[model samples]
Target: MDLTLGAVLRRGLLAGLAAGVAAALVALFVVEPVIRDALVVEEARAAAEPAGAHEEELVTRTTQVIGGMLAAVVVALCLAVVLAVVFAAVRHRLPGGTDFGRLGALAAYGFVTVALLPGVKYPANPPAVGDPDTVTTRTLQYFSLIAAAIAVTWLAFAVRNALRRRDWPAPRAVVVSTIAAVTGYVLLLVLWPANPDPIPADIASLLWRFRLASLAELAALWGTLGLTMGLLLTTRRTPATPATAAT
Candidate 1:
């Protein structure tokens, strides 16, 4: 099987779509209800406040659930595609050469960089969890952290490459890169402004559960997609299949 870029992309897209289906199923059956329950609590809190609160429902609950499922499927597929490209691009640079173990390690790295790193700073919240006035600011800060994480990771790669060119040992290169990335990450967290809106004590548990479920959502999507892509890419398949191409 030729491991051309197009062939890798085809395999990635297929795997990503499969992952999307799995993620959507989990979100629909498990995560969505937890979110809905949190929303209910939020709504009750609002209702108990001053009269004439905004009560219009432009989007119905049925519609929200359906739309959420669809969005999850689409987002999962997209993330899978990106992960596939990243995997293919970086596999050769790493010590292992297209081995399953290396592939799994890369997947874990992706989750840490793409999901967990930024997630720790700007944890996911229920619909009404944060202050409505600070939505834009909060969103900007969250994405800024994501961008910083990505940039730092790239810089670490540059550090490793530079070290490798200078006859540095593999372990030394890895250690330096890890230190640089971690140091940069910590500095960014310190410099970034924190979210001041405090979570109410009563609903803190529910919020925690919602955030956990949110992280689990990404973990499931990426884990499934990465593993599936790795397996499909490593295994032999017919040339007629998208997993392969013309020799």
Candidate 2:
């Protein structure tokens, strides 16, 4: 099968559709409920405040729910576009025996660098949990951690490649690189500033559930993207379908 820019994009869009739908469903069913629970706490808090102190919402809840689902798809598609282009560039060099394996590895790398590590450092909160004044500080911290994680990943892979180029054994290269990555991540986690806004203890359980659900939705996106693309590739390789295209 061809791994051309066009072909990979076509495949990626299809896979992304599957991924987006999966994530959207998770957001709607799992995360949304948690969000509603948080909103209830928020409403109660607002009720306790002086009248007219709280701002009225311009958008209705139903609209926001539908919009959230749509946003998930848009984000997933955008991320998939990035994945498609990146896979095309690094397809040959990725450490995998097959294209599927390579794509899966890339997706896993993305999940770690782009989603998991950063999320662990700064878990998502419900709309009402944080101090509004610290929004700028929190945003900067979150993106900074994401950048740090990606940099660490790149350096780790670079070190691994350097070792391989120096005639180091594959296992040794992998082990050394893995150690570097773990150490770098640990340092970053320790050094990066914690979320400035404290989690509200009143709704701690709801917050925990919401964070977990958010992670689950993200995991579903990447997992589906990888698996769907792999299945598509596998289908093309079956005996029933003769595939002969440039890779």
Candidate 3:
């Protein structure tokens, strides 16, 4: 029943592996095709350029594809480690009917804070869409918004906890917290800088598909990570001796 760091981390790593695989599958089957379609636009633009004007390709598509898959695994592993550490620290405080529910809630929250909010503000774009000149500006805006979103969410949680400590009704506390969080998010959305790059008509049409595919990949990673972590922690295992198990 001891929620030891080692035990939790071990489960987390395995969950991360499963999540990476699931995300990679989504990336390969869903996102990649949309990327390929966008790349066609890039290629056409390049072919239209005067000879020696287009940038030279340093990496082949095959290498990029493989590398992208590897990157997904690496990113998933990092996120899983963070999840494990956070769970170990705050699992008892997390609201849920069961451990599975707690972990699931955490995973869903992680997705919104880490992926959804930032993505909504600055949606993903395939190659040939964004302007190279504005990359730095866009990157800064994207990360800044993510940081702000996380801060807002954390503050909301703290407010809810404070209310609970004051003996406020749980439902009232949650409702108040939710309203505050939504207001904060709306303010952030209105204040944050918009993407500087103008999407070409062709790229704009493809943007919806690319962003949806990206969301699918992200959801797959977080959802699988949660599900796998829960199974690892909760699935009953038979012991030779009567070793006690903890939920």
| Candidate number with the higher lDDT (1 or 2) | 2
lDDT by residue for model 2 (52-154), tens = 9898799999999999999989898988888888888888766655788878878888888888988788898888988989999988998999899989988
Could you tell me the lDDT of residue 55 within candidate 3?
Answer: 81
- Cα lDDT of model 3 by residue, 130-246, tens digit: 898999999899989989988988887778888989999878988898898888888998999899988677566799999999999999999999999988877635355654654
lDDT of 1 by residue, 1-247 (tens): 3457677788788878887888888888778888889888878888898988856889998899889888988997788778778867876665443546556766776777778877788778888778988888888888888887788877877788789889898789879988997898888788888876776788878878888888888888878887888788778465675643222
Cα-lDDT of candidate 3: 0.86
Residue 79 of model 1 has an lDDT of: 82
Report lDDT (Cα) of residue 88, candidate 1: 70
- Report the Cα lDDT for residue 204, model 2: 79
- Cα lDDT listed for each candidate: 0.78, 0.86, 0.86
> Clash pairs of candidate 2?
none
Error of 3 at 128 (Å): 1.7
Residue 225 accuracy (lDDT) in model 2: 89
TM-scores of the models, in the given order? 0.86, 0.92, 0.92
